[model samples]
Target chain A: MKEEKNIHTNSEVLVKVEGLSKKFCKDLKTSLWYGVKDLTANVFGNKNVRQLRDKEFWAVKDINFELRRGECLGLIGHNGAGKSTLLKILNGLINPDEGKVTIRGRVGALIELGAGFNPILSGRENIYNNGAVLGFSKKEIDEKVEAIIDFSEIREFIDMPVQNYSSGMKVRLGFAVAAQMEPDVLIIDEVLAVGDIGFAMKSFNAISQILKTSAVIFVSHSMPFISRICDNIILMDKGKMLLKTNDVGFGVQSYFDNQKLLGALNFGEENIILNNVKIHSENPRLEGIIEYGKKSIFEINIDSLNDYPKVKVSILVYNMAQINVALFESRYISIKSIKGQKFIFDFGDSFLSISNYFITVRFDDLDNKKALVVSNYVNYRSFQVTGAERLVFAPLYLKEKI
Target chain B: MPLETRIYQKENHLKLGHLFKASFKDMLSSRFLAKQLAVRDIKAQYRQSFFGILWAFITPMFTALVWVFLSRSGTVTLTETGAPYPVFAFTGTLIWSIITESINAPTASTKSAKGIMSKINFPKEALVLSGVYKLLFNTCIKTLLLLFFVFFYGVGFHVSQLFFPLAILMAILFGTTIGLFLTPIGMLYNDVGKIISVGLSFLMYVTPVVYVIPKEGLMKTIMELNPLTPLILTSRDLILGNPPAFLNYFLILFAVSALLFSVALVFYRISIPILVERSNA
Candidate 1:
């Protein structure tokens, strides 16, 4: 694993954004009027006032970052948190209202796949069109057309119009073109979530191949992806940076903590509300960091409205995608639990992937065949599992003897 | 290759010359993309239509036929137009269509690419250049029709007729310049496009497209004052082997169009991103 340190101090900076901010109007009419006014003001030599006007709010504010070569910066945030806006500004699709961004290379952006494709044009023709839109010349496209078709694996349908191609095929072709461009700076936003798992893997391989040389900025809500690819992560909330860290696990944890603090509503009935949830290492003195190969305990406290018998508490550990990694049932603990109790689930070893996991505690009444309460069902409490290995995708680690 | 680029907020001072040079370089480098876009538009235009490219000829021919009917039926009396009625009307409306097309091309091109522009980052100049390409394609088709009418009217070719292409180029320059200036405004408001459409149709009447200008009347004064009148008149004179009239006015307009186009390019480079940003918002 590469040492997690500030690479900016030693490497050549490829992208530098300073004091960047953008404001957007809520209403279309007002936006248009403001555009005209700004244009007129600019033409007449009026200094651009950086303050917000009526009905305008900052979409991104006071962002500063420097990305060096061979380092990928992951931008994570909730929807409408200005991630896309920042990407747009970096791609030169829009200008910031208050700062400057200097990019020192050709930027190949897969912001939206197949953005300029003409539905009436054949796939072969659209390769030229879409490639040109990405700054490739006609002769260059002519030289690389075969490789693009081969990479997309859609050579059989290259002569057919794009309108006839299925959605997955379109994504394949789009990503193939973008991946082959060999840009010095790559800005990709949630495009890897497209296509089937096979194509996604192929795209990931392509990205990693590019990461060997280019400086990349990736925006995705997938924690596993960010943990896998990004050396530095910026956790953003409401258009402001909350934390920037070199530790991927810590960054993902900070993002989840911020999300929890933002009051993401819990869905379970208040009959058994979660009183407290805490994670600690096996050693009582050391807390917070969960290291791999060490026993850890998850303590969940629930407050019950009334005393109830035959209550079973189940602790479920889920990966970032909410897929269950492991489930621990109270039956294994040999505890006769009732309402209003603290349940401690202990694992022998933390063999889970080096990623974020969410714990969901479910309180069920066995006699009545009903769920009495669930703890943080809507927004589960997430914890990070850090390990020595940097590349781990699946939830569980297993060893097999040949 | 590492191509350095910068993004910044609106500042009080801008190096206009540097900005213009950079924008021109960007446009020139993206010429292949512009050509590809033009090819895409031209191919898609007639793909689903029953009439296809024939509509291009049918529109002006149909317009000329209607005006000829009105003249023959004595519904609208026209002044002496030395050439045969069909030939004169055809040539007039053909030139008029070319000008209107040139004026409409920029807005239409930019508007059609609005979806992609908001999502992808590319040189917006490519759209303008592609619009010019489409205009050229249409002009080629119209020029062929004009030659057919010229011979049909017994107006044989003369050495002066060699300058007809120059006149057509001037008309395009004039219309495209005005269109470029209107593009940003048009992208912001749908009403601009509608207004331009309505205004161009009405403007043709005062430009002497199908009728001679009145000798002495308020209409003549307005016709004489129209900047387009000199353009259409000089072009028509050249095509008919007559000494080009209003050459000075046309030359002045030509120079103004060039200057306006440069300004328009700068305006487009600055405003288009803002417009796209707002639209995305």
Candidate 2:
């Protein structure tokens, strides 16, 4: 056999997003004027582009990645890591503030379930509209209409208006349209967590069928799904990337590592003012911080930002719905003295049996009720927890036969 | 651990023109979507009601009566063929209802469908266009009621009255223009939708829809300046053949439509992507 050449072709990459960032801002002058002067400035100087301020909060910041033709790229990161921002850029639903993204074919992004569907219209009508949105023609949508309905398993209500359908049915129908249309690139956010287990299973299997030719950029906290299908993983945090790799297991572990680190470091205020913070976990995902039913460690470091302080640097456990479930305020619980700007909080010995949770740390200057209970003046990191926690935020005790 | 180094990469968007065209193309191809939207629009009001579609025309009919009673003292002056004041009032009311529905169509037609813009991949214009089809349905039914007045009320009309279609077309053109002009701005500025609706309501009386033609200088000029005024007066003129001096405003509205629509298109195209990426609060 002839020696192989080491050249990579353009066709190899289905997508190239370089320095992709998107920023949304308010017109400061208009915001300031609040009257006619601001209106004039908005109309005349809006396009000046130079007079624009950098007070921008970048939703997706400096994101760079490429997806090959058939690989599923898992975008795993804690909340606010800009995963949704990156997915929007790749899907062409929106543009970025500062990067270039190139894709070879039709891209279907289900950023959220039921996003492009008209609820007042019938399920059948929405399917056609969604198909068109996914880049299919009327004939094409027509051809796939039956298949789409069958896949969603909602044929009985196909003629009924979507507004009347339940949430799960809506998601199922939405996913079916996105899948049946056969887009070159498919971007799915955390919607897989929605629907019942059977439906989730159905969605994953359907997604698998599409993965044969489609280059997928899936942003989900579900490690099993990532490991099962993603050819590579892109781990991100706080609007930046943590790592990228084909080793799915390693990626999952890394996700947990930072998660644990962030939660442990930032979950609670070690002091009145929080400063230097971090989180880590043995599972690489550091998932133990938030996900239920997993044993994990949380490490926190704190410093005083503004001094009149009595605070706790500890872990605050929140369920996925953002409800605070429990908290380990380490400062009042443990530390007796302060030496410098650093304090650490350990979750002691606990395997968070809950399936899903997030870590949030605050330095409250007051009590739990409102009179001036300031959660310090800073926000910390969060991570995920995994293992035997087979569901979302379900705290349970497992029996092992080993 | 230190913060993960987020390497900056530039995201590339296809040219604005290309995306805009693509979005519009996406909207145009979905006949089924448009039909369904039109049906839904018409059905939403009358859905599950025992009166069914009759309520669509009845509500407007009663509203016209209240306005007529409030405006006139039962004068039989509206009689084109000795028809009663109520019949003449109904004619103006029917036309006004159609125009109101059409103008209101643009504002709500697309605005209500914001859910789809963020979730699906389809061009958003289909939603905007959906309103037009729905309004057209309402207009058709109301016009049928207008014809009912023509036949049963025994109103007299010259063949020149055929120009009413032209007048109605003009009303539609202006309504659609307003919709196209304001839809994007409404999305950008939270209050734009409310402002457009209110402004249109004020302009309705300024047009001859709710009142008679005014006599004077800048007031006439201002009255003439209102786009729908010309269409309304011209329809009455079709029955009488001496089109109002406001006829010049037709050309002006045509120009305004182009300008407003083009500006709307540009703004919509520019703001779309940014609007889509906002979190689902």
Candidate 3:
């Protein structure tokens, strides 16, 4: 294997894409009709596939990139941003309309785990079936069967019918086989987001090891994973490349900055309406920003038509990934005959990393079991913590004197 | 040791000269995967069933028995078929069933593997080869029962029986040729599959299955004109040790089907990616 790697030098370009594009129809009926027409054109050797017909739009447009051996390219974009379409074309599952994609050596895609597995068959039997589909000969699979079983950590259930196995077990087995495939060009989608944390970490480590040899194309929404593995990054949106740079951090930062903010959402009983949410800071320059070690006060205004005996208010803050980071709850407060009421909480010098965060306010019963009214100020009242960007493994930067 | 490079472009896909070479290479490479898939399907098909593989034999036998009962009860009158009527009906039904299975194989196999195709990039030819593998497995079982029926009816074995395998291969090839041509379209529109079964039941009547060819009439002319007639008659004649009346037609059909089968292979190669994109929807 080492000698083989030396043969295909690290600088050898394994994948090249030039002006690649594909058009897809939105309507099913029209798509089928176009399929018939495209097939006819293909049969007749017609070269008119580049033009988009009625009801068709470009799914991937004029995308170009090159990847060489031992280089990993990260593809970051929001959903429906043509990242998946680009990966499909690179994997050779579909054809491009305008340009060409030249890929050398064997290519493997981790698009979906356990894709070819038959549930009725035993896990052991499916390993062989899946291996064969991955282009492994019988003897080759025979040699790696034990290693795959060990890697999956389901040796005891190897002979058990896969239908009876848990979903996590199937994913483990699938990842095990894929990890062992030493393809020259590896296309990794978001398949790492499966199984439990332990298995996911194991697969991630295995993939990072494989990255040393193969020219990899990785697509994921997790910025940390992308920054950790990708030597370079390409940010895409609306079927076009937004940024192509060696600075993984800048690319990821741009991706976060490009996320569209959500509007204010206040939904519940019509009688209790959320009026406004405002933040007050001591420094006018940091009015909307929350610094790592600064005091900020958040005020919530509500108009209640009917008086409530007792209500509890809870404020939850979530990061850009929608992960809950902070929660502040107020004890029971009686509100009677108050048309306009206010609740205020002071956030004092909390150490939060520089990123965008949203707040969700919920008014629940005194017991905190039932919600009376809820208001989500996702992007409408979102706040950003400003600081010099630094590379850290954890989501939050917690500082303590040492 | 240079790596094997594959280039994908719309125009490159239309290169008819390279399509056959690539399809054949993929077919050869996918043979092992095809066998594995076929074995998995065959095992899973009968794994949990009560009767297991007995159903494969029971199905054709039951159909053959129904026709035999109809013939014996005077519900349908039939002309003399040289050998015993039960043997004649059973063999005819067996051959007809093989043909139908082959016709349905490509689409059926591709549909079953739709889950994998959209997710993984593999040699698409594997699905077609796997379908053929499954068809051959089922055919083997049916042929065993067919031989038993032929001998039990006392249509004593003859040297001409040596040609049975070749005759059967020709039948499968003919059926598969038609099937391969329809698979690309069939994967896109299920109407092709539904229409095929309906058309096949009607077509069986005109192909001399479960009945002898008419002695002299318009029915005979239709039977003679049917492409399947030569395949069925030649296979039955070879197995039953009768001088094949349609040997020349069978040979000609074989040559034509072989040529068409190659064309269909290339067409499938060209049309599959487009069909796959639609089916993924």
Q: Any residue pairs clashing in model 1, and if so which?
A: none
Candidate 1 vs candidate 3, DockQ winner: 3
lDDT of 2 by residue, A102-158 (tens): 776666676766555666678887776566556677777777888888988999999
TM-score for the B chain of model 3: 0.97
Largest DockQ belongs to which candidate?
3
* TM-score, cand. 3 vs. native: 0.87
- Please write out the lDDT profile of model 1 over residues A1-402, one tens digit for every residue: 123322224377889999888899999899999988877766665565678899999999889999987889999988888999999898888878888888876788878887789888899988988998888887888888998999899999999989999999999999888877676688989998778999999999988988877789999877678878998888888888878888776787777777755343355554666666676667644444567755667676666675556665566776654466866555422223245567676655566666777666666655457655533443456767775754445434222111
Fraction of native contacts (fnat) of each candidate? 0.72, 0.29, 0.80
Ranking by TM-score: 3, 1, 2
TM-score of 2: 0.69
Model 1: residues with Cα > 4 Å off, grouped in runs: A1-10, A261-356, A359-380, A383-402, B1-3
Q: Write the per-residue lDDT of candidate 1 for residues B1-281, one digit (tens) a residue.
A: 23566555556356778768877898898789899999898898887699889987877677878988999999999887887787777767777877898888888988888888977888988988898888888888878887888897789787877888888888888888888888888888889989998998789878889898899999999998899888888878887877877889889989999888888888887887777887662
Writing each residue's lDDT as its tens digit, candidate 2 over B1-281 gives 11111222222234545645655665567555666566655665676679988887888778767866764765533323223445556656666666667666755755566665555556556665677677677777766766676666566566867776767766776667666655545544657767766876777756666556556756567776765676666665564444445567766766776566545554455445544543232
Q: How many residue pairs collide in each prediction? A: 0, 68, 0
**TM-score, every prediction:** 0.83, 0.69, 0.87
lDDT (10s digit) by residue, model 3, range B29-147: 98989999999999999998999999878877788899999999999999888888888887788788878988888888888888788778888889888888887887788888888
A1-402, model 3: which lDDT tens digit per residue? 445676666898999999999888899998988888888888876676467788989888888889999999999887888998898888877888889999998898888887788989999999999999888999989999999999999999999999998989999999998888888999999988679999989999999888888999999876657877898889998888888988776776667656654334455655556676665456645555766555556677778776777776666766645566776566666655566688666655555577766567677654356655633333334677776645544324222111
